[model samples]
Target: MPQMSPLSWLILFMVFTLSYLGFLTMNYFSTFYSSKTPSQININSTSHSWKW
Candidate 1:
């Protein structure tokens, strides 16, 4: 088999890193939002009750 050029190797590395970062970012946001929603709902209810 033929060897890959340096540019091709660089491109492949960049694509892999970017995809991995994207996946991590997506997972982080999903977990963050999931944890945040309950607190937000509680805050909203508390604020609404305080208004009365």
Candidate 2:
């Protein structure tokens, strides 16, 4: 097998790290919001944090 250089290892690590960050960012920040009534909205705002 061919040996990999330090630069190649660093580049691979960076690529994986950035991809993981991007994945988490999109997963957490992106949400599905359907049309909700005013009462439902008020209840959600007043209640404690529970995304699920």
Candidate 3:
């Protein structure tokens, strides 16, 4: 088999690294992010299912 050059190896590593980072970034943001703020949540709401 033929040996790979340093430049070729560097390019390959960069491509793979960038692609992997991009994949992880995509997965990190794949979840549903809510835009609700503190004011949107009701403090006195009786939505709790537990009783004291």
Candidate 4:
């Protein structure tokens, strides 16, 4: 078997870290929004959060 260098190990660690962070962030945001009431409960556009 071939021995892996330190540089290769570092690169692998960084890739794994970034992907894990992204997965966690998505889960957190989804859970947060799912528990909130709809922001469009007010039919009036002037009172809506998406006012143009």
Per-model RMSD to reference: 7.9, 9.6, 4.6, 7.8
| Ten-residue stretch with the least lDDT total in model 4 | 32-41
Could you arrange the candidates by lDDT from highest to lowest?
3, 2, 4, 1
Candidate 1 structure quality by residue, lDDT tens digits, 1-52:
2466877889999999999999999998787434556546654334433554
TM-score for each of the candidates: 0.53, 0.52, 0.54, 0.51
Best by TM-score: 3
Better by TM-score, candidate 2 or 1: 1
How many backbone clashes can be found in candidate 2? 0
lDDT of each: 0.77, 0.84, 0.89, 0.79
Better of 3 and 4 by TM-score: 3
Worst 10 residues of 3 by lDDT: 1-10
Query: In candidate 2, how many Å is residue 44 off?
Result: 16
Off by over 4 Å in 1: 1-4, 32-52
Candidate 4: clashing pairs of residues: none
Sort order, TM-score high to low? 3, 1, 2, 4
In candidate 4 the C-alpha lDDT for residue 36 amounts to 43
Q: After superposition, how far is residue 51 of candidate 4 from its true place, in Å?
A: 59
- After TM-score superposition, the amount by which residue 3's alpha carbon in candidate 3 deviates from its true location, in angstroms, is 9.8
- For candidate 4, what is the TM-score? 0.51
